[model samples]
Each structure stands twice: as C-alpha cells, then as structure tokens.
Target: MKQQSLALHETMEVHEMLNLKTVSMTTSKMMEGVVFDQDLKALLEKDVQQSIGAINDLQRLLKKAPKIE
Candidate 1:
C-alpha cells in the first residue's frame, strides 16, 4: 500500500509539472507574437509617414514650376 501511494504521488507531480511547462511555453509564444505585431505596426506607420512626406515635397516642387502652354 505504501509503495502504491508513492507511485501515485510521483505520477501526480509529473502531470502537474507537464501542465506548468505547457502553460509557460504557450505564454512565451503569445508574447513573441505580440512583439512581432508591434514591430510590424511601427514599420507600417513609418512607411506611411515617408510616403506622405514625399507627396508633400512633390506638390511643393510642382507649385514652383512656371506654367507652360
């Protein structure tokens, strides 16, 4: 009976440890995805700003040119 109890306790401990490990891995993956998403958003915003600036510069240059028939 004592040996059976020890085996049962060990099995329970191992099961709990596996669950903890799974949770830890899942959390880590979620954090990594969040970080990647944030980086992508920042890069997209920067690209948009650059495009707007280029358009404004082009408009200004166009305004400076003399009109020709």
Candidate 2:
C-alpha cells in the first residue's frame, strides 16, 4: 500500500542519513590525527565531502517525493 511504501522510504532515508553522519564524523576524527600529510588529507576530505553531498541529495529527493496517500 501507499503507507507501506512511504514507511519504507522513510526508513531508507533515516538509514542513509545515519550512515552519512557516521562517515562524516569518522573522517573528521581521522583528520584530527597528524599522521596524514596535506595531500592525503585533501584527497580524503574531498571523498568525505562527496559522500556527504550524495547523501544530502538523496535526502532532498526523498523529502520532495509526494506521498501516495
């Protein structure tokens, strides 16, 4: 039914959001360590930003989707 579909979508949205937040936090913490050099840090930061941006875009799409009810 429409309700079930909406619930599934919402669940997926939350899962993705949580995953993104985790990745963001982990990457941020990793960056705090002085082991990595500037070049590597820049590359890693870019990847983290890309992942966060992708999740944000998905969240935006889910929010914009119209309810079937």
Candidate 3:
C-alpha cells in the first residue's frame, strides 16, 4: 500500500488547531471549578473531556507524519 503525506501547510494548520484545543481544555478546567451553576459546570466538564479526546486524536495524526526535518 502506498503511504500518503500531509502538505506542510496542512500540517501547520493541524498544529495550530491542536494548540487552540489545548488552550480551550486548559480554560475549561480552570473555569469548571469556579462555575456556580450545576448545569454549566457539567457542560464545562463535558467540554474538557471532549477537548482532551480531540487533542489525543490530533496528536496521533501528527505522529503519523513523515519525519521531515
């Protein structure tokens, strides 16, 4: 099977998105404890979990890239 590779621009965009998701996860974690509304708190926790999953998936994609210098 032939292997496929991401163009450099696409890889950079993915990296940027990964950074954005990481920042969102960090903010959600910090705010979760401070939120007073029960529903909002639960929602924040869900966002945190989803963000984590997204970061993991993105990291996996980054790992699959050809190790170009």
Candidate 4:
C-alpha cells in the first residue's frame, strides 16, 4: 500500500534525524568543557538538555510506530 510505504519512509527519516540529534547532543556535552566563553558554554548546555528531551520523546514515538520488517 502507498500509505504503508509512506509511513515507512517517514519512520526511516525520523530515525535518521534522531540519530543526528543524538550525536549533536553528545558533541554539545563534550564541547561544554572545550568552550572558553561562558555564554557559549551555557548555550551548549541548554542545547544538550533540549536534545535529551527530544531523544526521549522520539524514542517513545518510535516504540509506538509500526514495524517496517
């Protein structure tokens, strides 16, 4: 079915985005110590927190998503 195919495609795309965001979260945490500026460090920390929440939400959604295979 076209609908199933579309759903699978969207699920894959979301997975890819989730992976990218997870990597970004790790980099942000690591870069917190690497940054010398206080403002940038704060921003990175905030991004890290936001990414964590987003990852959790995405994972929950993924659990409810239809299996592709």
lDDT of each: 0.51, 0.66, 0.91, 0.86
When summed lDDT is taken over every stretch of 10 residues in candidate 1, the lowest stretch is: 1-10
- Against the true structure, candidate 1 reaches a TM-score of 0.42
Q: Which candidate achieves the best lDDT against the true structure?
A: 3
Model 4 alpha-carbon miss at residue 14, Å: 1.4
Deviation from truth (RMSD, Å), model 3: 1.1
lDDT of 4: 0.86
Ranking by TM-score: 3, 4, 2, 1
Off by over 4 Å in 1: 1-6, 36-69
Give me the runs in candidate 4 sitting further than 4 Å from their true place.
1-6
Every model's TM-score = 0.42, 0.47, 0.89, 0.80
The per-candidate count of clashes, in order, stands at 0, 0, 0, 0
Lowest lDDT 10-residue stretch of candidate 4: 1-10
Q: For candidate 2, lDDT tens digit of each residue in 1-69?
A: 443233666767666776777677577658747645887777767767777777776666566445658
lDDT of 3 by residue, 1-69 (tens): 977877788789889999999999999999998999999999999999999999999998887666777
Worst 10 residues of 3 by lDDT: 60-69
lDDT, model 1, position 51: 49
- By lDDT rank, best first, the candidates go 3, 4, 2, 1
Model 2 TM-score, 2 decimals? 0.47
Cα lDDT for residue 62, candidate 3: 86
Q: For candidate 4, lDDT tens digit of each residue in 1-69?
A: 333323666778779989999999999999998899999999999999999999998887676567657
> Can you tell me which runs of candidate 3 are displaced by over 4 Å?
none
